[model samples]
Target: MICIMLVVAVVTTPGTSMASVKMEPLARTAPPPVEFKIQGSFDPSNSYLDQGTATISDNGNQTVKISVITEAKSSVASIGGTVYLQKWTGTQWINVGSASTISASNDWYFSGEVVKPAEQGYYFRARVVHWINHNGVYEQGETTSDSRLVS
Candidate 1:
């Protein structure tokens, strides 16, 4: 017997594109573990970031949806930062679009979305940075999401 599956994943930003994928046959494999804590102990006086996630889905009518999520370890008041949707351009990362956020929470979470272009799909991910006053000093931290192939 033969089987096929359709999977939609990853996020995108404005002037960027995300792709959906179709697979043939299924394989039995173990899923990877999820890590929450930072590689080292998180310091309160220092800036830290968690590489968040992105996902893309087919929105029908020749359109796709791109969604990106980023997180940081600081809740300093009047916190502000930027979320960048980047695409791997053979050698380096290039920004496709970006958005900003401000929050008063300890754990910072950002989510943004955009409609994909009609043509031209590429491998895309999300990166976020916290650049604002943190405890009377300007601190910043950045992390990138996992790369996803869009078709």
Candidate 2:
């Protein structure tokens, strides 16, 4: 009877099978958003301009200027940037072909600026990048990406 009972138990509870169970680590913490604001820039890094409240000058053609600090001061070769210009329609703000930013940064990156839109009320931003050590090194200030507001 004991032997029969043991055989039945073994059949009912198949021994550990690797395929039968999966073990995943408990999530350390819930992930936050990648881009909370749609089509916007505000660098948590502080090296680039602030996204929330950037200065946009309406000098006929607009001009944007902002300060940035390097997180790690290193000998760099070049910088990369992603420029995005935001235009205000009657109701909402939309992007107007912010440059693809296939460009590299020279000394101008040390002090950054972007040309404003020819049309009034259009804002501009230049996400400056510093190319370092033959590597595309950059810091978007204190955020995921750098950003500025054009007037």
List model 2 lDDT by residue over 67-93, tens digit each. Answer: 333222433344434445555443444
Over 1-151, each residue of candidate 1 has an lDDT whose tens digit, in order, gives 8999999776655666544334322212222233363422223565644334445554434344656554566454434445566666655667775453534444466556656442234555555554545456665565555554444
Model 1 stretches astray by more than 4 angstroms: 1-75, 102-120, 131-135
TM-score per candidate, chains pooled: 0.44, 0.36
Poorest 10 consecutive residues by lDDT, candidate 1 = 23-32
What shift in Å separates residue 122 of candidate 1 from its native position after superposition? 0.5
The per-model lDDT (C-alpha) reads 0.50, 0.37
Model 2 lDDT, full chain set: 0.37
lDDT: worst 10-residue window of model 2: 142-151
CA RMSD, predictions in order: 12.1, 20.7
